[model samples]
Target: MTTITHRLPQKRHLVTDLPGPRSAELTERRRSSVPTAVGSAAPVYAVDADGGIIVDVDGNSLIDLASGIAVTGVGASNPAVAEAVATQAHHFTHTCFMVSPYEGYVAVAEKLNEITPGDHDKRTALFNSGAEAVENAIKIARLATGRSAVVAFDHAYHGRTNLTMALTAKSIPYKHNFGPFAPEVYRMPMSYPFRDDTGVDGVAAAERAIGMIDKQITADSLAAVIVEPIQGEGGFIVPAPGFLPTLAAWCRENGVVFIADEVQSGFCRTGDWFACEHEGVIPDLITMAKGIAGGMPLSAVTGRTELMEAVHPGGLGGTYGGNPVACAAALAAIEQMSSLDLNARARQIGEIALAALSSAAESLADQGHGVIGEVRGRGAMVAVELVKPGTTEPDPELAKAAAAHAFSRGVVVLTCGTYGNILRLLPPLVIDDDLLREALDIVIEAQTPA
Candidate 1:
């Protein structure tokens, strides 16, 4: 229960293979200066990481189960978030908290309004990513509920700008060809209990997603509903336990500003620092960003100090919004995730990754190698989902050949959903439970499907 030992070497070594030879010469100098629309699901080149490995540059150590996408939950080089981002980058690294102002951006907006999930009189702001804290939490819920239609669900993603890619619902590589996106933005239906076939519960999947948000928008023209209280990339989808307190009690009886989007399941990575606090469901605007700054480029929103003072003090900010060295690496990664409770180490890494991926999906459907249709998640945000054996369809090339054979046997694993077929995982709430059960036995021997 003390795990934070760093400086690499946790195990799983490998040596020279998966993009080896100095990461294939930096992936051929990152394919002549990056941008084949910037891919990289892992073709290895890291160089060095910590807690749960990641070395690379052909040296090869691997084993980090995708925490970078969940933003290094107090790991990748976290010596108290690299000495608070090297003492806030030797004094100053950007005076821009909307042009000169700091105290590490008001102590990271008083630590995201005293650690998120409602006490009531909350308020925050800070942003830089999670699509600028979800386009400023739909501009403070359409300027404190004057309303203008917003909703968003069905395999939702909610980021990649242009009003979070029109509140993302996936269109190959996050709304491909970007498109005529930012409009009124409506989409619903999501209580995905392993591909919902109508045996509904969770308040009948929140009354069939509030009957498609009251027949597609007009609970007085919405304003904000934006979810993801455990639906990252939509495959780690955990909806049905009274579907987010009956869609947050019908967005608090139609005033509509629910907005969770705890960007990749907020700090402590889902073992409840906020996955809408496992159904206590408070969100009246949350939208944080990948583990709030252990991997900088911070983001936030918080809310309900009358909907974050309903905009207009120079109508919300940005000029590197709140960058005093990413609010001193998010106040030293939220004081090393609340002095390393890391939300009970993300429910003990989600009860050992849901009992080792539910016993490797019941031993790969009793050796029929059924392509694991589900595994689900909670703390330490897990996933699995490949499908098509007895047919739940999706198998994204067997989840990209079981994450390229668990990154050629060293273990890195990431993949996601909206039919990319979800591998997920997101380790590092201070990893090392025997190197996370030997990287979940090399992701159940490289994603089963033989």
Candidate 2:
């Protein structure tokens, strides 16, 4: 069913029940066919999505707060984006960028160079997913630095590919049965202010991690040190103020490249154009995806020109890497983000969201039954890790219950983190104050003293 919602005062129509009788029947059928993990997030299937709401086959409209896991920065069904995609599709689709060079793909590269951080000459190679971008970054670093070892922080999530899985911190869902990952991957503790004690502050945490690397993986043997300015699935963690700069300085001093994985926190999702901009540390490579092309499957690796040149001719290319249609959509999405001041808008949304959720946590703290252990993130990319209390313990039960309660109503939220105890909110920046407040109400009610 196609959804029609124009302008403000968004209308939510639930012609059927939450799952409706038809959807329930379809879901039952799905159990026999599809893997159960498919429906783990929201059992209710999405029939249609537009603006900031998802309409189910049962005709239940849900206010989307997950933004497709922070992929759709500019609303779900942007008219301009739709027009761009349609226009490009009518003309042509694929011509492997490496085989037959195209203007659209080159234009995207030029745009990435101009938009990405740093005044140094930058180069970009388009990819199909965040994992691809990350893998490419590792390859680039290895080739440029002529080293085999890479240092990654604990709680970091790069991607799901073999190499990326080795880089990823958690091993439950992403790396459970899969074995024998890429070599030269090292994981170290992060600047988790919420967890550490003693005087091991944020910069101190970086120092500690760096000290370990200095002793174990010498800079002479390391290719790069990959990090996330604001960890996405790892509890929405925001590292200490000087952590990134300190690490970057160490990398520069030791002849190791610094790669920032901004897949989840880039493209205006974190108020800044990229989370790395929060600090002026220009990395040797930056992997980006998610909101890069609005809702389209687009990812890129922007890097120093000389470093990117290390790759051999025909070393990197994909048929769908820069499909013209997706490129056109990306152009429109970037235009929308700039003209609409979405970066500033992201800050506004984040400020309001933090205020509301933090207030709720404080209220419960007074009662000694608080679940929101900590609220941490930058700009609109925010999360609340639920815990029993006074401890860093993960509260998966509360998080699951909160998510289910939101789904039962009309709000769609996503639960993430290694522990699956973080309630992540990625509402479209276009969401109205009223709708946002209403969604907040649902969250509060779910955790209320019922």
Among these predictions, the greatest lDDT belongs to: 2
Per-residue lDDT tens digits for candidate 2, residues 366-444, read 9887777898778888888898876778989989898888888878888888788989988886666667788877877
Please give each candidate's TM-score.
0.39, 0.96
Choose the strongest candidate by TM-score: 2
| CA-lDDT, candidates in order | 0.84, 0.85
Going through the candidates in the order shown, the clash numbers are: 1, 0
For model 1, how does the per-residue alpha-carbon lDDT over 113-148 read when each residue is reduced to its tens digit? 888887888878887888888988898899888888
lDDT of 1 at 363: 81
User: What lDDT does candidate 2 reach at residue 258?
Assistant: 94
**Cα displacement (Å) at residue 59, model 2:** 1.3
